[model samples]
Structure formats: C-alpha cells, structure tokens
Target: MCTSSVCNHTPKPFALHKSSSVEEYLEKNKQWSQSITNETPNLFSDYNSKGQQPHTLFIGCGDSRYNESIFNVKPGEIFGLQTVGNNLNLNDETIISTLEFTVLVLGIEKIAIVGHTDCGAVNACFDDSVYETLPKNLKNYLKPVYENIKKIKDVHKDDIPPIDKKQLSLENVKEQAKKLLSVDFIKEKFENNTLQILPMIYNVENGLVETIDL
Candidate 1:
C-alpha cells in the first residue's frame, strides 16, 4: 500500500513524515561520517580545515542514473560539473569562470567529459523529424548539441546518409572532448602534462563505461 502523497493510493502519510525515519537517516549519516573520520582523521580534519582538494573534474549529463558516486573512485577525488547537456559553452562567462577556478584554484589534475547512451538531449538533436516544442532557454542550451550534429552531418554528407542517432551520440561525446580542449585552462594543462582530459560514454542498458580516446 502506497501512503505518500505522491503515491497513487494512500490513506496515511508517508513513513518519513509519520515515523522517525528522517531522524534515523540523519543518525545513520552521522554514524557513517564518524566512521570516515575515525578511519582518516587527518584527511577529514584537513579537508574540513583546508577545504576540498578534489583533483578530478567530471562533466556529465543531468541524467539521474549517471550517479557520480558510483564511479568507484575515492571520496574527495572528483569535482563534478553536471548539466542538462555535457557540452561546454565557449562564450558562457560562468562556465569559463568555473573552469579557471577548478584549474588555478582547485588544482584539478583530470578533466573528464562523460556522455551516456540514449541521452534525451542527444536524441533530440539527432531526431529532426520530431517536433516537440521546447522552451526558449532549453532551445538555446541545446544549441551546442545541435551544432555538433551539424558538424558531423556536414563532414559525412556525401558518405553517410544522415547520421544515426545512436552513432551520433557516441560521436557527440568525442566531439565534446575536442571542444573541451579548446578551453584555455584545459589547453594549458594539456601542454604542461598537469592534466589528462578524457571523454567517456556509459552504456545505460549494460551498465558499462567505455572510454573514448580523443
């Protein structure tokens, strides 16, 4: 029987509101936090006192299944930058500012642009026959994905018959990796060997992560 307000059929409030589950969740988190502190007291204390030293910057999609925590990397290792689309804006001041800060201030050692299979953004850009109207801001935001599709379309115009959505999705990830290199901070890191930028694609159906070499 579903009891939450969001549930279809319910007569009582959710267990979270009726019971002390919220408190229990907080208590469990506190216990876990203490366990981490006990194991790595110095690093945790230093992290608290000196702020984050996350060396990897992960840029991925807004997909809920693309959980960054599931990367199997150690905690405090990644500085995540998620968006609706994985593409970075060359002209966006905020994105540029964050990039500068991540390199100059955070001293991030790696930059990874990750794209997952069956991404709605990539699908939208690939399928021109669909006429799902979008908001103005969303249209503007998806321009980069559209642009990448156009570039692929142009290059393979005579050879290929309108890129396949699935293949274009993979190519989009590779294209985004090259686009990432155009950033000044990323370029500097590439030149000095201080950072390694990689593009990766995750197969949602199979739960597999495949690295794309750019």
Candidate 2:
C-alpha cells in the first residue's frame, strides 16, 4: 500500500508589536538561538562534549523571573537546587539527596544560598494570620522561617511590623545556609575548610546581589 500526505503552508511577514519586556526577551532569544545554530555551532559544542563541572552549589527561590544566567555566571560552573519558596527542606528526602550528591559526589567547594525581595512565600507567611489556612506540607515547609521569625525577641514590636517581612527573608536565607552546614557531608567539608557556604539577597530594585552577613 502506498499513501501520500501533502501539506499546504502559508507564510506571513514579521510585524513588530508593543509588548512586555518578557515577550521581547523571548523573541530576542528565538532570533539569537537560530543565529547561533546557523553561524556559531561551537557556542554549545563544549557543553555537549564536556558536561557540568558545577563546583558551586546554588540554592535559590523557584521564581520563574529569577534566571541564573542573568548573573553573567557561566553554565557548568554551578550546581543548582531550586525549590518553591526557597525553603530548605532538611526533612525532604530529595533535598537531602541532592545536598549529599552536590557535596560528596560533585565535591562542590562552595554553596551559595540566595533569597530575594518581594517573595510571595515570605509575604504569605507574614500575613498567615488572615488566611489561617494552608496545606500541612506547606505549613511544615515554612515552619523553620516562621519559628525563626518568632524568636527574634530583640526586634521591637514597632520595628517588627514593617521589617518583619524583609528581616525574615534575610534570616531565612541565613538559617538555610546554616541548615545546609548541618548535613554530615557538608559539616565535615565546612569544618575542614574544604567547603564554604555563603548567603546573599538579590535586590529586586537595583538587580544587585548583596552578600548577606550571617
């Protein structure tokens, strides 16, 4: 049996339109990718041949808009662990497994914990009094931050309200770095000075990455 399927195609000329920067970014990447494949085949050839070195483990928020490449850091130089809400899940098996692999297997010399401003999770935790409801897992996931925030006895009530969100965000990042240090493999490397962990906050306002002094 012989059968033939034919297709009809229509083409349209490119027309510029006013759009969000995100849309413009997508369009630009589309053009750049096509141009790269056509003109610069070696651009990604090493990536295919070598694979990921990723000596630094980066744990950050799962925000779609916070792309690592925007930091100008090259690929295959950092091992990344992105989780929703940037909550360090010590109890989570997957999180622990990744930590172990990054430290022991990958022998990552440095781990950086990154938190950002205007985090939806931090905002929600700050205002949980209103919602009064959240899933058990989610509640559990955010327990460390909530508990840490509650323990900030030195922060006055007046100073507490506004800075609560921001302070907790920074504290959470610091605590996460500490929590990562608690891992057996991590602790050994850290104590031996073989691995170093640092925390940072990415300012949404200036797009600046500032080291968080723990």
- Count of backbone collisions within predicted model 2: 0
- Scored by lDDT, model 2 comes in at 0.72
Best-performing candidate as measured by lDDT: 1
Model 2 residue 19 CA deviation in Å: 14
Q: What is the lDDT of residue 23 in candidate 1?
A: 76
For model 2, residues 1-214, the per-residue Cα lDDT tens digits are 3253432343323333355477787887788677766765765676735666677888888875474654666546777888765777797888998898888887889888888888766766666563346555745556554545444423434662565667767877887888887788888888999998888887776788888897
Q: Candidate 2: misplaced stretches above 4 Å? A: 1-43, 131-162
| Candidate 1 lDDT over residue span 1-214, tens digit each | 6666567654454323445677787987788788777877776666756677887888888787785665876567788887765767767786777788888899988887888888877776655554245455755556655655657645655664556765666677787778778877788789899989878887888888888867
Which lDDT values do the candidates have, in the order given?
0.73, 0.72
**Candidate 1 lDDT (Cα, whole model)?**
0.73
TM-score of each: 0.72, 0.71
| TM-score of model 1 vs. true structure | 0.72
Q: What is model 1's C-alpha RMSD?
A: 5.7
